[model samples]
Target: MVVDLQARLRDALAGSDVDELVELGCDLADAGRQEQALACFQRAVDLGQDWIWFNVANTLRELDRPTEAVTAYQRAIAAGQSDAWLNLAHVLDSLGDLAGAMEAYRAAGQAGGQPEGHVQLAHLLHQQGEPQRAQAALAPALQRGYLPAVALAARWRWENTRESADPVLEQQLRAGAGVDGSARADLAELLIATGRREQAREQLQLGAKLGQRECWLPLGNLLAGDDLSAEPGQEQEVDGAEVDKAGAEEAYRAGIAAGDEWCHHNLALLLLQRGDVRAAEEHLLAGAAAGDELAQLAWQDLHQQD
Candidate 1:
């Protein structure tokens, strides 16, 4: 049955207070009531709250209605809220309009625009395979202490050189760990690189507990290896110590819930090892749908089986 959002709104929106409506909309959205929140935002806009269009756009985005979100974001931009450009750029990127996203990101970083736009711009450049440009664009974000930029730059260095992270970058990641889960994950990786398996587990555990669901990926691996271990009952190194298949499954599921597609691939591997071929296939498809390369390859290979 559909929710009677208007009736619910009538209980709290009896006043003409724009701020109240916006606050209620935010509260509703936080509770996953996007349609009700959308109504609240739209009502605020009808009451001359032009700035509320940004909230409407955000709600629309959360509702997976990108076309309407883009329109609402455009209206907010037209009303002189340049920060809407940042969100609009993200929507364009999600819609696969890379060039448009690039242009919109540029607009979002200009005067009166969102400063974090530069960080996202750098991220997009990286996605488009322009590493040099991504690094260059990231400079400003780094200077501003943006955790994603710091993490990306550090990752690039480690990926290209196969050496330990630079001391300064390592320190930055540590400092940012309190606020960014990725920072904790990176720090754990640095520890893992140095053969500090136990410390790495500690970092991953804390990060996962702090609501950094992505940490579950590494944590799960550190807990259970690909061997499944039910036969030989052991692997080696981090997870080699003790193969907690149940814990690994839990971690993978949590990571999947947290939007890390790669967890599906790992979880599929575990399921396959358990002789749950159908379950493995299901997770492979889910991972493929989320653009996980390993999952896509595994799915293709599985489909080609004799």
Candidate 2:
């Protein structure tokens, strides 16, 4: 049955007069038959189906072959599929080929495509330690309601130390936290670093209530500090211990049960500090396998002890 279907698909592809081959290629790619899909897409491109190149590029990217995706996107651009240039920039950025990403972003801009190109260029510049240049690049979009402008402005205010009490920054932090995990974590870290531990705790508490795993590590650290100092007094105590060790243990177990990587890493550290090496190793190993860098480093330290 599968062989008959394959033969039918081949005949249909062979008889394609327009872009039917591209559609067939896309279907094959979506169904996880990547090698066959690539062949079909290559044939479509050879038949002068200009639009097929973007699909081919996207498929290559999804298959974890960014270099080939870059080439495919470039071919699409050369064939006048200018709208694909922004996506090409994004693929290059994901591959850590920032120079190529910048070039593609520039081409996307020239093509009058997404305004996000400017924001992406600015972000890349900021990451490369050219904050002033990044801010300059973001200037045009700043007045146009681009969300990245808030982040860029916050970064500028932070770097310049205009004032730690800047209301603009506070507003930006709140707005940023509403958008993504990384932004919320950044705001929390910044608040803690600036001695606004209470505020950071509040933000983290809200994040925890909302079921955000990203808040657990910093929040746990904060709580651990408070625990060591005996905050909330005897009223919050559990298991006949100060700082509610029982509650902390429960939270840690809940996080572990939910498979949170950061929770596992932080909980491992906490347990290690409490002299529970066996449990610590288990959680740390799980976290390390999940790509938690801190957990991996901690595991290395543990091995050195043996």
Candidate 3:
């Protein structure tokens, strides 16, 4: 994102008021010139433009400086920028200040943010082991038939109950699968769970071609015959099934290349089972460093054996 500011743009900025500077900052931010945008925003703020602290916070967040953004957001809130409360909550959540984020989210609603704030709060609550409260938080969005909220509610309920899929939710999920790699992975997983292994494989293969990272894990699992144990001389061999060990390895490697850390666990398992302990340990270490729980557990077990 190399952006060269034109002479005309520079001339415009030299004569702009605080409002114009904020507008220019927004435009620059939108165009991926976040550093330039920050400069514009900071310049405006320095000239007694106290009300534009929210703009300053947004630019800081875009720069991936969340701590600075938090301060600017608080200043914005103090200056009566109500929307800053919602934004500040997002930053706090990113910083693992969940309790603070919860408070900020409540304040956002009271001080007036979008109705979608409920959905955001609900997701956070669910993440923090308060599923009941999370469901309660979703009530407002559910009443309005917000799609993101509805889909999330369905997914959470599915995780708990494993009940038959509703037609409406299935349709929504399929639509999501068309656009999102994780959704492709989720849809393929659902198919496999319902005894449609071939369909899952086909869907995952198609999504892999679409550059979807998550699809690769399930695709590899399918190739490896869904965790079927290897025979004394053969892999996942049961009822004449031939586990495509090479194919599975390729899929796992592809997934890793595509930034899917979870693939390391399964690949490590495969290698470990095949007596390639060194390679498996390398992957386990990498996955654990990437914060993958399964890989972490496997790595711990390996250490305990030592």
Model 1: clashing residue pairs? 236-240
User: Total backbone clashes of model 3?
Assistant: 0
lDDT value for model 3: 0.79
**Ordered list by lDDT, greatest first:** 1, 3, 2
Q: Indicate whether candidate 1 or candidate 2 has the larger lDDT.
A: 1
Best by TM-score: 3
lDDT (Cα, tens digit) per residue for candidate 3, span 37-154: 8888888878878778899999899889999999999998888898888899999999999889988887775575555677788878888899999999887767776666666676
Give the Cα lDDT of each candidate: 0.80, 0.71, 0.79
Q: How well is each residue in 182-271 modelled by candidate 2, as lDDT tens digits?
A: 456567767867787778768877776677666666666666654433322334432332343544555666666655666787677667
Model 1 ranges with Cα > 4 A deviation: 1-52, 55-65, 225-246, 271-306
Error of 1 at 200 (Å): 0.2
TM-score of 3: 0.78
Question: CA lDDT of 45 in candidate 3?
Answer: 78
Q: Which scores better on lDDT, 2 or 3?
A: 3
Report how far residue 41 has shifted in candidate 3, in Å: 1.5
